[model samples]
Target: MTLDGHCAAEFAGVQAAFEAEFAAGNEVGASLCVMVGDDVVVDLWGGVADEATRRPWVRDTVATTYSVTKTMTALAILVLADRGRLDVDQPVARYWPEFGRAGKDEVTIAQVLDHTSGVSGWQQPMTVDDLYRQPDAAAALADQVPWWTPGDGSGYHALTFGTILAEVIARVTGTTLGAFLESEIAGPLGADYRVGMRGGLDRIAPMVPPPPAHVDLASLPADVEPRRTLGNPVFSAAITADPTFLAAELGAVNGQGNARSVARLQSIVTGRGRAGGRAFLSAETVDRIVETRTDGVDRVLGVPVRFGLGWALSSPAMPGVPDGDVCWWTGLGGAVVSCDLGRGITVAYVMNAMAPGLIGAPRPNRYLAAVYESL
Candidate 1:
């Protein structure tokens, strides 16, 4: 496992941890990046990106980072709030009036950002194609009743988080979420991340599915939150390899990038809403990320989560993340990204070979431990 990349002399432990994972047969193709303030402390990648071609995972290798996409979408919404284009506390229907239907008239943008809007997943049946048909998917969500009472507790809007919010972004910004992200955030920061990939199929490392988790959706009652939310459009990890899926702008799940790109983009939050010598968000907007919105057992994920505006706050559920002004999220397979405002650090890990489970996968946690320990 010849890992190729740089690690600052002081953070050799982090590099060793990364190499250990590869040596232990845990990573096929992956990248890990850690940035302190404006400096990139560790930027590393290695292994075969495509098992078929045995393509090397180089510096620019990008992959579909499942729910980690949520952080980018959240950043977009927070930018809107910072610009006064949208208000977090205002009713979401104020922008997309159609969303007010089906007893969601009072749902707030803050609730949507924090995953407490109760429209966790679509009530109607859907296929992967339905996700690409944004208008139809948005309409289906706008028409359905929330699975739980609004703001009662989060249900972890795994997929719908981006779909429902993208409509609001389009309504408010006069541009698609991907376009907005590129024009305002990713492009200026020089981050090679995209909401939906345009023409870089050759660069993408397709996701390899982990051993399937045994969850009998049929045995679980239809009305159960996890069954309702995760099962409505039960996604296969292999869907990430489909070009159509990569092209479609599903902000909640289909973000494409590697660890370095993710760290670069998220550095905005860690740098107090300013990165690359530009102010993308006000310091006040960055402060809003730590404001707790939901702090209890999430109905859908079935784990205790502390969701803030657009990211998860440090909590017991995520054991290794350092406490204090920290916000983070993870993708389905094993991609993880975090911002520590107090210490001005951002750490990101992305891989093609996914470990089983969603949040708190051991791979990222082990890397995170090395990072914090080095500090």
Candidate 2:
């Protein structure tokens, strides 16, 4: 387990915790990056990027970051709001008229951001391939009824989150979510991240799918929240390796980047919507990012979660994160990122090997715990 990159002396425990994962065989290839203010205090990568080829996980390696992509999607929308091009409080249907159909006309963009839109998953039966076709998929969602009462509570949207927000973004900006992110966010910041895979195939670290989920959708009742949200198209983590899936802009799930790139983008929130002297979000928008939208047991995830605008507020699920005004999210497998506005700390971790469950794994827990302890 030869760890690479740099870690500040004050954060040596974080480095040790990362090395211990590989030593314990809990990691394949991974990268962990920590940023304080504008400075990167810790950056590290090691292990095999591809198990089949025995390729090393280099400094520039990027992998499919699952739900971590949500943070980026959220930021893009916040940018629009910051610049007065979009309003989070306005109904999503205000931008996309068709989205108003089927009782969703009242669904606010803030509700969509907070996972309380009640359009948690597609009502129509869809194949995984349907996820790749953005326009058709977005329209399908626009025409459906909410799974639950909008804004009553949150049911993790899972995949539909991207579709819903992307449609709104497209309606407002006349650009795809990927294009808006690239031109307005990633391109300007020089962050090596994208919603879809294009170019740099050689640098990708293929993810190893985790064990199959224990939920027996077949046994569950048809209208159950988990079955409805997770079973429609069903999730297959192997999509990270599929070129066609990688090429499509599935803003909720298919974000491709390493820890460093994820931190670079998410840190804007930690900086109160400004980074590198650029104002990506206004102070008011940043406040919205941490404002508690829902704080209770999530209908789909089946756990107590505190959701803010587009990310989760601090919760016990992420034990490594310190208490304060913080917003964060995790990817399938083990990828996790947390932005602490009060402490001026942002930590991101990405990996090839996956642990069980949709969110939170032992690997990131260990590293993040070490990070705060060292601090």
Candidate 3:
């Protein structure tokens, strides 16, 4: 279980932790990256991408990292805001009038970015296929009344974050979120990340969900918030690998990239909106990331969370993250990306093997601990 890629001598401990993860069978195929200021201190990947085929995870190999895609979606919005084209303080309906319906006229772009917009999930049941159609997906969520009052508290908008953000982006830019992201964010920085699959189709690693895969959705009470938020549009790792799902612009969940690309793009926020010799956002815009728009127990996730713009604020719920003006987020399985503006550090971990829960899984946390230890 030899690890691939380079690790700075000082951060060799972090590399060892990554190898141990794969050696312990905790990671089928994964990539871990750490960036300091402008230098990449650590880059590593290993293990079988496809168990059935025995294909090794290589440089270009990417996986459908679930909600970590949210960071990219949110970054696109931040870029728009930095350009003075959009204001987080302004009502989203001002840009997309259709979004103002059902007591949502007061909901601002900041609220949506922070997941306190109250339209977390579509009250109407949605399948992965239905969400593929951009217009239909937007309409389903627009027509429904919010389950809670808008801006009351954070309810993790698991799937609808991208759908709602897409409408706003399209209305303002006259382009899809994926296209805008490619042109404005990923393209300028030359990062390999994508909102939807467009290139390197053969390099994607198939997701392997944790064993005993089926969750006990039936055990939870019918009215539980997690059940309501996650159950409405329930899906598994298998759905993420589907060709139709991959082709669609499901930005909240369907991003395809590896640890290298993730750290590169996110370093823009930690790097004061500049990366790869380009300035995609102004310092004022990057500062908005830690504005603390919402704080308290998350309705959907059933845990304490603090959201600032589009990233989660450092809090007790998220252990292993350093204390400072930092923000982070995770994908559905075990994928994670943390941007520490105070420390000028960005850490990202992307894996094909799906862990059971969403936030702060142990494997990535151990790697995080080792990274901080080295620092």
lDDT for residue 31 in candidate 2, whole number 0-100:
97
Identify the runs in model 1 with alpha carbons over 4 angstroms from their true place: none
lDDT of 1 by residue, 1-375 (tens): 778889999899999999999999989999999999989999999998888789999999999999999999999998888889999899999999999999999999899889999999888888878889888899998889987899998989988899988999999988899999999899989999999897979999988889877667768999888888888787777787788899889999999999999999999999999888889899888898988988999998888999988899998877878889999999997799999999999999999998877678899999999999998
TM per candidate: 0.98, 0.98, 0.97
lDDT of 3 by residue, 86-185 (tens): 9989998899888888888888888889998888888777887888898899988766777788889999999889899998898899999989988888
Prediction 1 global C-alpha lDDT: 0.91
Q: List the residue pairs that clash in candidate 3.
A: none
The best candidate by lDDT is 1
lDDT of 1 at 142: 87
Give one digit per residue, the lDDT tens place, for model 2 in 175-234: 999999999999988899999877888888888988876767778898998888888887
Per-model lDDT: 0.91, 0.89, 0.86
Shift in Å, residue 368, candidate 3? 0.8
**Per-residue lDDT of 53 in model 1:** 89
